[model samples]
Target: MKNDFEEKMADIMIGEAVTALLDEGVAIGWAVLTERLRLAIENETDENRVRAGLRAIEEVRREMHTRASERTGLPRVEDRSAHKLH
Candidate 1:
């Protein structure tokens, strides 16, 4: 169960990410959005909020890919970072 603060953070982060994705279209990739969300949450002091924000980011990205792929009848492209040696 998420606390109020964590839930609030997830809402804020997910809302912003969805807005950006919708405004910019599906060309935005996972790495770019993840980097933006990471920067947004970098200074957050609460670990729970930070974790929630990251999870929200992933949720938005996955949904974006699913929707876009469905609309375009194209396969979802995997994130480049997924193949990289991190």
Candidate 2:
């Protein structure tokens, strides 16, 4: 029962909403990862354990960057803090 313009508008609105939700989810995920890395660094006493934790954190970060780049069709930016929502 909808006209072509109305259908197109609905699609556009849906796309925007989906993009917003994805962005928020990514922000929350990054915040959680950052907190975990901070805690690991702060509480760990052993150098090896701290190094391992840092490696794990870095791996997760790289994976997230790759996924985001693939999704957006844009190259990954070096300054992740600039993209932080907080």
Candidate 3:
């Protein structure tokens, strides 16, 4: 029973860590997309389309930051390099 409980708790913690990783990945993806969108806007000739793309990217970025903040319990990256896989 003791071993079983330990295994279960380990699984739970692993699940939480995985969730955090996925969440952080989403934020990273948003940052990458934001950079791309900025470049696209600059290259595009139409001002209205550029503005629309910028707005959409900003909204996605806002949500990503918010969710990452809540999940990590830190406004910025809580840890730059740290992960255990086994």
Candidate 4:
């Protein structure tokens, strides 16, 4: 079904983004990572899928920061009143 295909594609995209994060570390900023992924899927003609991919990237980044903060005993940047996601 179309729903199943979309879910799988999102999962794959998230996995690739996670790999990129692990491989590149602090060097890959959120904007750069999103742009890199946008380029990777530039051939994807569906606007909806492209938007979904962007959402997935944001979600992955949020999850990463959340987990990191949990393990490090530091507040996530989002938790800081003065700082926000870059």
Steric collisions counted per model: 0, 0, 0, 0
The segments of candidate 4 whose C-alpha lies over 4 angstroms from its true place after superposition are: 1-40, 82-86
List where candidate 3 sits over 4 angstroms from the true fold.
Answer: 1-28, 74-86
Which prediction has the highest TM-score against the true structure? 1
Which whole-number lDDT from 0 to 100 does residue 16 have in model 2?
44
- Which one is best on lDDT? 1
- Clashing residue pairs for model 3: none
Q: Model 4: which residue pairs collide? A: none
Worst 10 residues of 4 by lDDT: 26-35
Candidate 4, residue 21: lDDT: 75
- Model 2 error, position 1 (Å): 66
Query: Candidate 1, after superposition: displacement of residue 13 in Å?
Result: 2.5
For candidate 2, what is the lDDT? 0.59
- What is the lDDT, from 0 to 100, of the residue 16 in candidate 3? 44
- List, residue by residue over 1-86, the lDDT tens digit for candidate 3: 75555445434433443455567774435566556556655786765555565565655567688788889786544343354355
Give the Å error, residue 28, model 1: 9.2
Model 4 per-residue lDDT tens digits across residues 1-86: 76666667777776786587778774666666766677656787887677668666666678778888999999887788656567
Model 4: residue 67 alpha-carbon error in angstroms? 0.6
TM-scores, all candidates, are 0.50, 0.49, 0.46, 0.50
Arranged by TM-score with the best first, the candidates are: 1, 4, 2, 3
